[model samples]
Target: MRKWGPLVAVCLGTFMLLLDVTIVIVALPDIAGELGASLTGLQWVIDVYALVLAALLLGAGAAADVLGRRRVYAAGTALFTLASVGCGLAPGTGALVAMRGVQGLGAAAMFATTLSLLGAAYRGRDRSFALGMWGAVSGAAAALGPVLGGVLTQGLGWEWIFFMNVPVGAVAIWLTLNAVAPDGARGTRRLDLAGAAAFALFAGATTYAAVRAGEEGWTSGRTLAVFGVAAVALVLFGRAERRAVDPLLDLSLLRRGAFVTVLVAGLAYNAAAFGVMPYVSVWLQTVLGLSPVRAGLALLPLAAVSFVVAAAGGRLLHGAQARFVLGGGLLLIGGGTLGQAVLDADSGWASLSAGLAVSGVGVGLVSPALGGAALASVPARHSGMAGGAVNTFRQLGFALGIAVFGTVATSRMTDVLHDGGAARELAGGGAAALRGTVPDEVLRTAFASGLDGALTAAGVLGLVGGLAALAWVRSPGPEAETEAKAESERDRGDGVPAVGAGAPASPGGA
Candidate 1:
């Protein structure tokens, strides 16, 4: 237990970072009302936080390698805590939004260094368990956010949501300094400032286009311009990464099977989770008319099941084949999400909870398994890079999932409402009422049809993701079993740096 204290602190930091993503959604109306934010401004409040975090992930990882992980981690905690206070105290929505973005920046720094620090602190079985625990805790945090946010928003105030982080973050920072060693890696690598800037701009533009496409329509000049800029910037960023000596991200890592597969899985997992959850919340509150607190409480089954399954999954890892475990998990997730397509006004909490439970179980199974697989594929020396790469893909997946899923949900809702005779009625009292408290009967009729369609679509996408993984990730038992036999007869090769021999000096692998 003592040996794992630092790991727990890092996991706590990770949990806090992920929790902020969805916690704010449950309080969106409150924030908007207090700050009088426009719809576009409200979108920015959410998207900007994700955008900044995604953009800085790779750069921050490299920074930790140079600056010393403990120093960077402590500074990140301080920045994040300070920003949270700023968010809580902000007089207006714009101020809160800006502070949230600052919080994201701090989160990026901490996220990049966390796993690397854990790797340094634990070894063998203990290290694997720590990584698995981290993954489990992160997922649970995402699931728990709405409940915690709703409780705070309803019982205390929205400001308490941000303020809640202060104590938790302080504890984490304190533990980080005293329990963890100074640096995870020794290096004199230069920061890829230009690459970082370009990547940030490109990611922001692309994500902006994806998110706004539903609201602004595909043909809107602003949306088109965002996509265009994103395209150009992405191309330029790729070129810059290829040419840089020490790039913020090592694109070459893309060639490895384990790394690439896990990255893909990471993307798919986020796409499913982000795409599905928002709609579920809407179904419960907007269609079913549950209060925010009630809606939040509805998620407890998923939370409880996910926590238990994730805990069990770590034990399964020692005996199971990675591919089999991961593929099966994805399949379950797909099955559960698809089941949500059956949700309607009449469906009770049992049905909803069951679907969420299945998805949660699936998520629990695959999340950490993929991370461990990715790290194992590389030599121990490259664990930091491998871990960072995995996280980058996960964040990118999250951004994409939210963007694409949000587009689908919004478009579907608009279409259904426009076609129905009650469209104007919905646009009037329903919209107005929806801006505040949602009543059950009103929510039931409003979301009954729309929720089914959205969940069905999300489930299909999830199932497709699962099937794709199944096809690509072979059954691990036979191949791995055979390899085990061959290994005893052969000498394990010495570690060779993945960087090719005689490769000329390029500027960034910092």
Candidate 2:
């Protein structure tokens, strides 16, 4: 009970953080209507959260080690709670976007410390089980986000979606304060400010360029300048990391084949699954004419199946080779996404449900396995950094996926409607413009065509991820497993119970 209490505290925060990702997706249409935001504005609302989180995660992890994991986690929880309040009370789109960025900063702190806290609390087989449980929570939270958001948006209001985080975050803070142990002392390692700055600049610049290209032309001067800035920042980041005594990100992790494979797999899963979810939600509402509640219910199959699959996948990671599981998962995702590409303006909910279920299963299989593989590939001491790295890649993939898919869909729709006056109105007025100006038949068909194109691209990316896993991911050797078990036995022999047994009580003894 004592050992598991901290896990619960961290998981609660994780669930809220991830839930915010998909929750806002279903609410975007409502937000756009109320705020009079353009399509580019919607993209920023989504992109900035991921962009900031991805940027700061590396630094957060390093800071946790140097300062204290519990301290960082507590501070993050407070910030997230306050920021959620700001989001709910935001006066306009700009205010909401800024608050979301603040929420991302808070989320980065909690996320980077989560796995490290678990590692500190548990060991050996118990650690594996804890991680699997963590994975399940992640999938379930994401799965529930849309439905919950939809229900809130339709029944209460869109603001309730952010408002709901307050109580949950409050509870999480209490649990964290009571359940987690305090750090023994601060480490002497210097914070890698240079590496952190360079990486953040590179990531933020690239994402900004992608979002700008989606609105302005790809070749626009502003976009080109941002791209150039991104390129130079990335080069500088690499140099800074190489020279740093304590790099924010250990570039050497890329040299390990397993780590690289896991990273790619993580990116692919997020790109195909989390990245495309918002657009799908929009399509359901605008093209299919489903209300927010109905649209959320429609996505239930994907979330439910993913939730179950992630739990099973985590347990499977104990005995099975991650390569097979990850490859198989990616294949499922590709097939599922490809199925969605077949959707047409006249298609019913049955087709969408089937495709979503398949993809959810794939996501389930990938989530836990990818996390486990990334942690296992790195040295034990580097687990916090490894966790941050994996999440950074996943979030970056999410940002890129949203930018690319949104651009494709919007551009294709514009091209189809180019001759119509409504096209110009859409460019300026956003989705609200289509409500009365464009004919229903024309709007549906054009948007459907754009959706198909986007799905096709996402499907191809999923296939590539699967193939990469198959080619590169491998099982740890039997000797390594034996040594790990022996280490566990030695710990037990030294009067330490396995985690979840009679392990040491947390500091405050919650």
Per the 3 Å backbone cut-off, how many clashing residue pairs does candidate 1 have?
11
Model 2 Cα lDDT, one tens digit per residue, 283-338: 78766768889989999988899888877765455677778888888889988988
Clashes of 2: 0
- For all candidates in order, the CA lDDT equals 0.67, 0.76
Indicate which candidate wins on TM-score.
2
- Candidate 2 collision pairs: none
Instruction: Write candidate 1's Cα lDDT for 336-359 as tens digits.
Output: 877766655578656777788888
Could you say which candidate leads in lDDT?
2
Q: Each prediction's TM-score against the native?
A: 0.85, 0.91
Which regions in candidate 1 have their CA more than 4 angstroms from the true location? Answer: 37-40, 256-258, 345-350, 376-382, 419-430, 434-446, 474-510
Query: Which 10-residue span in candidate 1 carries the lowest summed lDDT?
Result: 501-510
